[model samples]
Target: MSELLLTVKELKDIEKYSADGYVLGYEKYTFFGASRFSYDEIASISNKANVFVLLNALIHENNIEDFNSEINKLAKLDVNFIVQDTGALSLILKQISPKRVVFNPYTMICNKNDFSAYQNEGILGIGISSQLFIEETIELSKLDNALILLYGYEPIYQSNRKVLSLYQEAKKVRFPNGQLYLREDTRDVLYSIIENEYGSVIFNCKKVNLIRRIKDIKEAKYLLIDTFLSSEDEIDNVIKELNE
Candidate 1:
């Protein structure tokens, strides 16, 4: 059976459509500067579905104090925590027992060496980047680790500068919804939008998709199918198609 990993928004929709029976996983949009959810919120959501929560280290530029508190609360709920950041990772290892933690893609774990380093740190899984060639994935599978990706948009560039400025100037207007978009050369914009538009680009790098590379992930210890705003329907459809 195929496994799926969804952003918080898609998971919300899935809960509505599946009547709280759909197995759930959560990803923190760290690049977006969104606030961490409270423990009560986490438990409420997790209780609604078989859920695992990813702790975003990129949130507010990786506030260690806040990150620690959030993970502590999640651990109290007995919810699975996927963390990014060396400081956060080290803190979790030292403060929280290893049983409730998972490693997140934000850790930038790219190879077997990276994987080996985390194994003893109680990391149960490692997310492989979509940019990796098939050979790299084959090598990754040889290591004992769970891996995840989805057949959707990959996050690409991240910046400290407000990206929405470019769009406002080009369009000669501001967004009514107050959403931000970075301006780039026309060609660069198109390529970036197509290749890395899902995860927040303001802070985290763009995520790469491997929809065409699903077969490679099958060899992984676990496969996490991801979905963000642009391809929610596509995610559900893929899951249905693959599972059917």
Candidate 2:
């Protein structure tokens, strides 16, 4: 368990970031900001650092056949798989090592009871829900083999429907293809959202920026920093801070 940076070369100096490893989104299974690396690229990155692939997309029925095919190709690489969907987990288990497959269904796991149950089911590790407040999260970090997606806007909701597309069509307006945020009339907070062919995902308004507390939360095995929605300067600052 080391620091993980979720990114693509969209940010420079990833190798110089000094993270325990680098994380890339699986083109077919991971959501927004997916690096969409080719198989040769996957092999290349693994040689540089430990590679973690996020298969966090809620797999649609039609994509299963193709996604499963991608899993087979990925299994040959020395990379760890972090998955959200149960069906995707089952697919990885069929080909990847159990130790390398991590179950990370966001916001579903909160307390020790839920975590214990997943452990009982033979899941080696799981990402702790970011919904838990600071003190509560510190307590859960005491548990063995836990991981925290400490910094970044965690995706709170995902749907198979193209909500944004429907909105654009109905309104007859175009939104930028880059990240967009939705805000309620009275609320100051804005929720980040993006839509692709797989679906739309709404991210938490308040990012879980806990980089400053890294030393205090030593019991947790892994701490993750996501670079999505961040510029090279932003992520560069983060990496420098973490290593300091």
Candidate 3:
């Protein structure tokens, strides 16, 4: 059976609810961080919760050293890391080891070959792409170490450029939370945008609600729930639905 892995966006979630298996977004590139958390802050949260750190930031050559340093520090906590960048993976493999690594290149592992390559690399677990059809996911879940995204906004675009910041400045408005939205000119689709020190990432407007389909992926190792840009009550309701 797969475990429900909730995303800890706010300290209030930690205070109000007990997340035995949780993932924390500590830096700017992730879901929670309009305000970045220090390593000490991360440690404080991990001490109270069973935490897995999300280092899904898009790493470039310029930030490789800084990224490596962060990973090295996180290794001391003895928590697993969910990595996106290849450079970050190399650092983890060298400094940490594949045992503590969970590879999630946001919508990249779509087929069996991808799964095999990752498994051969000694990766302990891998995230299935959110963009894949349910049938593809069902086929891939048979792989023993698959991690499926059971609920969340699917990430569509990510870039190091501060697109949201520039747009906010041009519009003469500050989105304090550093979140905004863009709608298609032809279609009625809206995409959520989050910008910070690391860069900007745009996600699908509608949340992916697979609470009803959990049985389809029970053979997997983990089921991820990303609670970004949601209210406290809304999050609680989702959790309640999952439990039922």
- Per-model root-mean-square deviation over C-alphas: 5.3, 2.1, 2.4
| TM-score, model 1 to reference | 0.72
lDDT of 2 at 182: 90
Per-candidate TM-score against the hidden true structure: 0.72, 0.90, 0.89
Write candidate 3's Cα lDDT for 97-171 as tens digits: 898888888778999998988888888689888888888888898897888888778788887779877877899
> If both were scored by TM-score, which would come out higher, candidate 1 or candidate 3?
3
Off by over 4 Å in 3: 18-20, 28-36, 167-178
Worst 10 residues of 1 by lDDT: 191-200
lDDT string, candidate 2, 1-244, tens digits? 4545465653234555766767777657777653566677778777677787877887879889998888878878888888888888877666666677778888888999888777665655678898888887888788766788777778878888899999889999998777688998999998988888778988888777888887667778778777776666887788778767
lDDT of each: 0.54, 0.76, 0.77
Task: Kindly give the stretch of ten consecutive residues in candidate 2 with the minimal lDDT sum.
Answer: 5-14
Q: Candidate 1's residue-wise lDDT over 96-179, tens digit each?
A: 866555666543767888788777666756666556676786677667665655544555554544445565688899655533
lDDT at residue 19 of model 3 (Cα atoms): 48
User: What would the C-alpha RMSD of candidate 1 be, to one decimal place?
Assistant: 5.3
lDDT (0-100) at residue 66 of candidate 3? 80
Identify the candidate with maximal TM-score. 2
